[model samples]
Target chain A: MPIGFRAFALAGTLFAATLPAFSGTLDEVRKRGNLVCGVSMGLLGFSEQKPDGSWTGFDVDFCRALAAVIFDDPKKVTFQPLSALDRFDALKAGKIDILSRNSTWTLEREAGLGLLFAGVNFYDGQGFMIRRDNKAVSALELNRTRVCVQAGTTNAQGASEFFSTNSITAELKTFPDGPSTLRGFETGECDVMTADNSGLFAERLRLARASEAVILPDIVSKEPLGPVVRNDDVRWYTLVRWVNFALINAEELGVTSSNVTEAKRSTKPDVRRFVGVDGADLGPKLGVTADWAARAVAAVGNYGEIYDRNVGSKSRLGIPRGLNQLWTEGGILYAPPIR
Target chain B: MMVSAYPALLIRVGIPAILVLLLGGCGTTIDEGVVTPGALTERPATIRNEQLIGKWGVASYRDEKDRKRVEAQARAQCRLPYIIAKGPSDGVMMHLADDAKLYELRIKGGSDGKTYLGPEAPPGEWQDREILSVTDREMIMRFVDPEVHGRYGTFIYVRCPG
Candidate 1:
């Protein structure tokens, strides 16, 4: 076939393929009777399977919140564990309604792949971990140190850029994957090991002398991790986006699962709007019931509750809030008004 | 002849009218209420302290239906008006989020062309309050800090009748 005819044929095929999804993912999910959520195979604190064959983690709670919004029951969801390489492909193939894995919202991933990141649920970044005995307070102190990084990952480049920009010279040692790189660090092959700050926290739990190693406070790259959906469904995209915003807004409004019942009776307009006593149109506008936000909050609590339960001081990982803190409290996290 | 002259008439009268309508559309677009992303780059907006320094009635609400009732309540408060005093500096005296003491706040402009009233920091800083809409008889403001916004909601000031 001629090149022009082939190009036209591909365009026509693409248009036809996307036509059905544009109608909406919400209707399909409703008909299916459950939300199909894509998540990691197992990443502790973010997403991990328990002994009971049920999934639990920060990412898992987001899907639960979505399920609550749709079905008014958090349990109305199926977790589809996916590898990093196949995550986007699975979403594109219509295998999952939403991907709640700790995937970075990068320009290439959104534009190149036909996907849209809902909103940044967690702000993560490349960070280095070193032995506390080294007495290094920051990444800057690791000048001329050997840094272990996973091969074929962005951590090596992030480490190199940080060192070069700060006028510090550090040698980067590569390992095949996260476990081997961590092993290399533990066996004294390198002075430092680098990955995403979240990954470092998860890996540190597996360390022989976990308390002996410390994750440096410095973040070398911007990694705004969020839930992703296919770009075809605008209504579903809006629904997912606001579910995240609703969680953040609930935290801002001082509404929690414990006090949500009391909040419904509050005279305050914003509180009333949040608890669904007011702004009855808001939920239906998102293709859910009037008390969708209230249900989600009751199911998973607010963003702060989710963070504290899964990853923050309350969790085993015990990661600091850092940039994940609310914008009012000197952190960058902010959500637009519900009204 | 009338048909031929219609084009000339359209050029003379309709074009300027269309221009006016387009300009009016642009005016409403300025306050789309999209949050300004980063620091302000344009020059700070000039809101004369004299305009704000007056005895005004103040009330707050999150819902639109409560606006009229709150406006009435604010007007009634004019018996003992909420005062906005001229600061020692060129700015007006106002309280920051979670602050008890009043500080001098300037009218800062964002690159997106929205006006904010806050301290010396950038517009949309934690201390700043974006001027949602302001006029001679009424001025509305919302806190830039989400915590403060959550707690206080939007504030409305109605000018006390002389």
Candidate 2:
């Protein structure tokens, strides 16, 4: 019976890890002593693990930001690499505290699956990438083009919809995953490839000649990518949402990791409150600490810092802050005020 | 104390203004005082005396390429640190970091605590940028073009060190 009891306990722990996000994800994450974040399986600028076993990328930094708020240490995050298909199931089953993978926040995923999208961290859209010499100026110009699309993704459906809507005949070559799709595209199995524009850019680099491929400026569908938590825990949801907003607002307020120390000492009332120097106790309300936002910025920098370093002009992905920018800016990335 | 209420007031005032402009538009002439979001009715010939007349450091930016690398590229191009300046008659002049190529941008202020900056053109001639925030040392702005907005969000610029 000694071994039997141990076996059951181990099984219970494993089972608990896969349960739905219910009750207190906060308490569970705290007790476990680390925040488990579900990330994509190495999407270059979005989330990738270096040879040193340390993770870096936009999504990875987001998790680190969350961990910094919770534990005051970005290293406290455990990045669990998940595939696009499995990422949501992982979050839903409580295998991860947060889903930082570049997941599209869809109505079905949110309202139907009991998951809540905190906010769009990255606003992406489906687009077509083709050979620059192909002379197709727009998606409409892509008539009768052979397209490579990944299977089991919205990109496949989107490609089909675009072709149909535009009344263009398309030969869609479906691949099992991103790498395969890129391989197909690289080998000229298809004349065009479709995915979230960011993914297309990431995949383009894997090709033999990156410059040969050009992502069409036209975008077809809206893909509001962001972190997701279960709807069961409103407090946890609020905290996660605010963490993203904090990063965004921090950037808008001109707070960067390098200047966060100076920002904390800012005489401006807005800066003081934003940096948690003179704000009402907010951490306690989120089941963390009042200085949680400060810690997060100190660890991972602001949203723009994270963006530039990972996906924006700094990283190889070099995705623009288009619709992802704040509403005040030309982009639609408007976050509610922290107060 | 009232300074803290600016954002909320902006939303309150800006929303109605935007709705009114949107609904009233069918081909209204610029002379009707149609206060569109980025369409300034009064176009100045020179930068003159505007609030945006100084060097601004690039705090953050986003585009189709890596922002930090772009910044580094810009730094390599500039004689001084990356900065946007407002010169008389030339509007706001921003120097590209690497080539130090100067771009003259037109700028105007709104009653809603917002500013517009873009190419040197008459009011409503071209899509101007919307400067969302500007303080003693900080400036946050974005292009007013929906296409550009859909591509790169707003940019945050800090006042350059003296």
Cα RMSD of all models vs. native, in order, equals 25.9, 21.7
Q: What digit string (tens of lDDT, one per residue) describes model 1 on residues A91-154? A: 8777788999999999998999878999999999999899988999889999989999999998
**All models: lDDT?**
0.85, 0.74
Instruction: Assess every candidate by TM-score.
Output: 0.64, 0.60
lDDT of 2 by residue, A268-330 (tens): 877888877776576677888877887889998998888777777666666777777778887
Error of 1 at A179 (Å): 2.2
Error of 1 at A85 (Å): 1.8
- Highest DockQ: give the candidate number: 2
On TM-score, the leading prediction is 1
Poorest lDDT segment (10 consecutive residues) of candidate 1 chain A:
A1-10
